[model samples]
Target: MLTYRQTPPIPALGGIVARFSQRRCREAQRHVPAFDLPARLDRFIEFYLGEPVRVGTGAESPRAVPEVVLVAPHTRPGKRLQMLGDVDTFTIHFEPTGPHRLFGLPLQGLADHALAAPDALGTAVLRLRDRLARAPDFDARVACATAWLGERLAAARPADGLDALVAARITPGMGPAAATDNGRVALWARQLGWSERHLHRRFIERTGLPPSLHGRLLRFQSLMQAHARAPASPLTQLALEAGYFDQSHCIRDCRAFTGQPPGAFLAAWPDLGRP
Candidate 1:
């Protein structure tokens, strides 16, 4: 049997973490189908305690999954991953600027890439992984990971000036106005007394995508989330509610992000739309 669970972060860590999640398969399996992870704006740090899975982009040969990996926001369509044998993994889903703030890594270079934890985060992660493997249950592992993250959070460099302002405004659950406005970058630059170019560069350094592209992904994610909440709703209605100009516009975004129309894409993997 396979089970997946998502748990919210503690109240104090809420700003840095979106959630903690676990995926486990209790028995070994001969064949497991690959799944598509649709493009999104959040970053993740995943820990694998069992067999390594395989991951790849479209049409490319999948590679063995790392024991611990740090994934940046996927600006491209998304990647494919398949689990074999028994699977057990835990993941930390970070806010848009969480990784940058916590690790002081420039996100632009990491965009669309998944790096081994040791390379991206150093040997300390290996120790954490060892602790996680030694834990008796999923909750124990979550506690271990949370404690490690808390230590990092305490030592993390504080965001300043534009970074602090942008981080405050653009979070994982930011509203549609900040996410759907096409001219938000220019408006923010003016409001913050910075040049548009400066704002664009700083935003990419912090979130791994330009403001416009990030907004587009946010809008697409909003539509998918709405569909997950109201599966019976018509695409047109969801599109309008998600800030798309029309159903056709939503279809174009679906095609761009998932390589299929909304009906076919969502029909193929109904639950993938949920966070």
Candidate 2:
């Protein structure tokens, strides 16, 4: 079994969320309840010194990731961040932006550049684990960790920026992709003056997934949302609004991504993956 404890404090210059997880042998079959994590995240700082956790026995299999990008427990601070595959259970989150903060400049640009440059950010993060481990008190730990992050971020702000675009064809009421706007994505990227490759690269750097995959994830989320609002809605209608043309098309993608059919999944987790 797996258990988690979380202590979330007020948002600081950079938001901090701490989660402690304890789990026995991992079961890839285990499905973590669905949850919508915030859209923007700087990076996750994880320090776990207990039992080892494993994912995808063969390294390319669909291991239990957190249904999203996660910083795995065993990945120490200095190593390149390991993509936490769908974890049987794990908890860690960091959001650099909150309602208020004193630093007015963008830091993700710097962090990304630092992280990509010979893993400098990784090295600093590795030191964080050691610093926190030696901290003598609770207040000291938080203060020290926050300070460690602030210094690296202050110097490394990158020249580039992360951006958000209002997706034209994927909005709440947008019709099927085949009907409403088949090339909207290409047009939007062109309008932003970014090539597909550039867009995909930045997205992957920040989101841990390519834009193509991100599109699919968003579509899946839309389907799940529409279903929750009208449980009895026909599969055809659900598919159309969610950007799929036919029921079979939607089912195929759903099973491939979530490993479950829509109806059976809803039956088991009635509250949209929440408790």
Candidate 3:
């Protein structure tokens, strides 16, 4: 049996932490299918308590994942992950700016990379991992994670104006004014009293991708999310509703992000559309 649950962070930690999730698989002989992890806007810190997963890109052989891993915001497609044996995982999903503010890690260098948490965040993470492993239940694990993140939050630098702007305004699809991409970028720059170039540089520095590209990935994510919500919906309808110009546009993005066209990709991984 596979069980999964998600818990929102305490009100105080809402800005930095998105949520905490736990997934466990109890059947050792069960065949767990490999899935393509799509590029995401948020970042993650995952702790494995049971068998490590195997992750690989393209034709390369999958590698065993570390016990603790930090997954940065991916610009392109992500690695395929396959689980083996029994699995237990606790993950911290961070806001786009959360990891940079809390850990002082530059998003620029972390993009498209999954680093061992202990190596990136040092021994403190290992200590927290030990505590999580010993946690009595999911609630206890959340408490442990909350306490550790709270301590970090105390000394962490607050997000700057750009971070706040991106978090608040630069989301999937176009902004409220319904302007072209360049126009929206210009408007955002004016709000911050920055030139367009400065905005681009700062956005890349903070989020590991240009704002335009980030918006594209977010739009792609929205299409997948919509498909997940209504698997029976036609692709053209989903595409138009997700802010794509047309089905062809959506197809192009699907290929770019998942290396397959919409129908083939969804058919091959039917579970992706499951809620």
Candidate 4:
């Protein structure tokens, strides 16, 4: 059986964090093919405590993943994951600009690649990993990780308000007045009192993708959530409600993000994404 737990970060780190989640499974589910959809908006930093996990970008096959991995925001799918043996994983789901705010790294550089945590943060991440591994219980693990994050935040430079502002706008419905207008980065720029090019540069630097692409991905996420909640809902209705131009537009977006046509997508993974 698979069990999962989710907890919010400390209030001080709330701006950069979405939540921390842990998942464990003593035996892999045989009936369902275990996999994960492409991450959108929030980046995922994962810590594996069991056998090496397998991940692949295509239907061809999967390769072993390292102990620690940071998955950047993504749209084009084909990313699949399979857990082996008994599994225990702790993950950090970061807000859109959290990668920049927390790690002090260029978000674009980390895009779509899962580099070793040690490689990304040198000894600090490795030290944290060791501490987490040594933790006596789940609560201890959470305490250790968040304490490490607090120290990192203390040492790291502060984020520009603009980065937070732009990242905030990329979410589903929480930002400036004009945030609801899809694909209108220029209008958002005007609303923020900044030039479009300037806003685009900051967005690429802090969130790894341009504003338009991020917005589209968020829209796609909405559709996926909608489908999960009400699988019987009409496709056209879900598409239009989620901001797709039409059913075809939704299908095209689904294909681009999941590498599967809408029907095939729903059929292949009725549960949609890994927990």
Instruction: Tell me the tens digit of each residue's lDDT in model 2 across 128-170.
Output: 6566657664455566655754564444433223332422323
| TM-score, model 1 to reference | 0.89
Q: For candidate 4, list the clashing residue pairs, or say none.
A: none
**TM-score (C-alpha, index-matched) for candidate 2:** 0.46
Report the Cα lDDT for candidate 1.
0.79
What lDDT does model 2 reach?
A: 0.43
Measured against the true structure, the TM-scores of the candidates, in listed sequence, are 0.89, 0.46, 0.90, 0.86
Q: Give the top-scoring candidate (lDDT).
A: 3
Better of 1 and 4 by TM-score: 1
Model 3 misplaced stretches (Cα beyond 4 Å): 28-31, 170-180, 270-275
Which whole-number lDDT from 0 to 100 does residue 77 have in model 1?
Answer: 69
- Where is model 2 more than 4 Å wrong at Cα? 1-45, 58-121, 130-145, 156-162, 166-182, 200-208, 221-249, 263-275
TM-score top scorer: 3
The lDDT of each candidate is 0.79, 0.43, 0.79, 0.73
Question: How close to the true structure is residue 109 of candidate 2, measured as C-alpha lDDT?
Answer: 31
After best superposition, candidate 1 residue 270: deviation in angstroms?
A: 5.5
Tens digits of per-residue lDDT, candidate 3, 35-145, equal: 776666668999999988889977887889889999887766768878888889999998777887888878887788889999889989989999999999999999999
Candidate 4 minimal-lDDT segment of 10 residues: 174-183
Q: Compose the digit string of candidate 1's lDDT tens values, residues 1-275.
A: 66778889997676568888888875534434687777777789889899887888777977888799998877666688777778888889887877888888889877788889899889999999999999998789889989999898877767566655555555444565465465767777888898989888988998898887777787787788778888889899888877777788788888888888999887776342135
